[model samples]
Target: MKEQLIEKFENDMKKRSYFLRLLLVIDQFFNVLFWNGSQDETISSHVGRRIKSGKANRFEKLLCKFLSKLESEHCKKSLGE
Candidate 1:
C-alpha cells in the first residue's frame, strides 16, 4: 500500500510538471506573437465606434477602459521601445 501511494504521488507530480511546462511554452509563444502594448485592430474599431455613437452602453465604456489598461501595461513590458 505504501509503495502504491508513493508511485501514485510521483506520477501525479510528473503530470503536474508536464502541465506547467506546456503552459510556459504557450505563454512564451503568445508573448512573442502578441506581446504587451500590441493593439488589436478590431478592438480599436469597436472602441472608436462606441465612443462616436453617443450612446455607449456601460459595458462598452468598461471594455475600453480595460483595453486601455491592458495596452499600457503591455506597452511597458514589450521590447518594442
Candidate 2:
C-alpha cells in the first residue's frame, strides 16, 4: 500500500509539472503576441535571463514552436483561410 501511494504521488507530480509547463507556454505566447513591442522586448529579455541563469530547459523551445504553429493556424482560420 505504501509503495502504491508513492507511485500515485509521483504520477500526480508529473502531471502537475506538465500542466504548469503548458500554462507557462501559453502565458508567454500570449504575452509575446498581444504585448506592445517594448513589452515583447521585456519578455524576450526575461527569457534570455532564464537561459543565462541555467533555468531554461529544452522542452520550452519545443513548446514554443508548437504553440507558434497553433497560433498561426488560429490566425489563418480567423482570416478565413
Candidate 3:
C-alpha cells in the first residue's frame, strides 16, 4: 500500500513543472509538521514568511485542492465505493 502510494505520488510529481514541484515539496513539509502536532497558525505564519502573503494564499488553495483529490481517491479505494 505504501509502495503504491509512493509510486502514484512520484508519477504525479513527474507530470508537474519544476516550480510547482518545489511548491508542493514545501507544502508537504509543512503538512508533515502540522501532522506532528504543530499549530495550524504557526505553520501558516512560517509559510507566509517564506512566500509572499498573496502567493501563500494561492499556494494554500492549490494544496487544498490537491489534498482533496488525493483524499477522495483514497476513500474510494478504501471503501470500494
Candidate 4:
C-alpha cells in the first residue's frame, strides 16, 4: 500500500510538470505572435476581439499580461534604464 501511494504521487507530479511545460509553450507561442514586430495596435485589437468573442481563456489573458511585462523589461534594458 505504501509503494502504491508513492507511485500515485509520482504520477501526479509528472502530470503537473507536463501541464506546466505546456503552458510555457503556449505562452511562448503567443509572445512571438504578438511581440515579434512593432504592430502593437494589431495585437491589441486581435486580443480584444478574442475577449469579446469569448475565444480567449483565462490562461491566455494571463499570458498577455506576462508577455507585456516581459516586453516592458526588455525595452527598459535596451534603454539602459
lDDT of 1 by residue, 24-81 (tens): 4564555446433223223334444546676557775676667668685332233221
Q: Which 10-residue window in model 4 sums to the lowest lDDT?
A: 72-81
Every candidate's lDDT:
0.53, 0.51, 0.51, 0.53
Q: Candidate 4, residues 1-81: lDDT per residue as tens digits?
A: 999999987986787787775664564466457655232223444454455577877765665566568675332232210
Question: Who wins the lDDT comparison?
Answer: 4
Assess candidate 2 and give its TM-score to the true structure. Answer: 0.27
Q: Candidate 3, after superposition: displacement of residue 74 in Å?
A: 16
Instruction: List ranges where model 1 is wrong by over 4 Å.
Output: 1-41, 72-81
Q: Which regions of candidate 2 are displaced past 4 Å?
A: 1-16, 36-81
> Candidate 3 vs. truth: CA RMSD?
11.9
Candidate 3: misplaced stretches above 4 Å? 1-14, 37-81
- Judging by TM-score against the true structure, name the best candidate: 1
C-alpha RMSD of candidate 2: 14.9
Model 2 lDDT at residue 55: 70
lDDT score, residue 18, model 3?
92
lDDT of 2: 0.51
TM-score of each: 0.33, 0.27, 0.31, 0.28
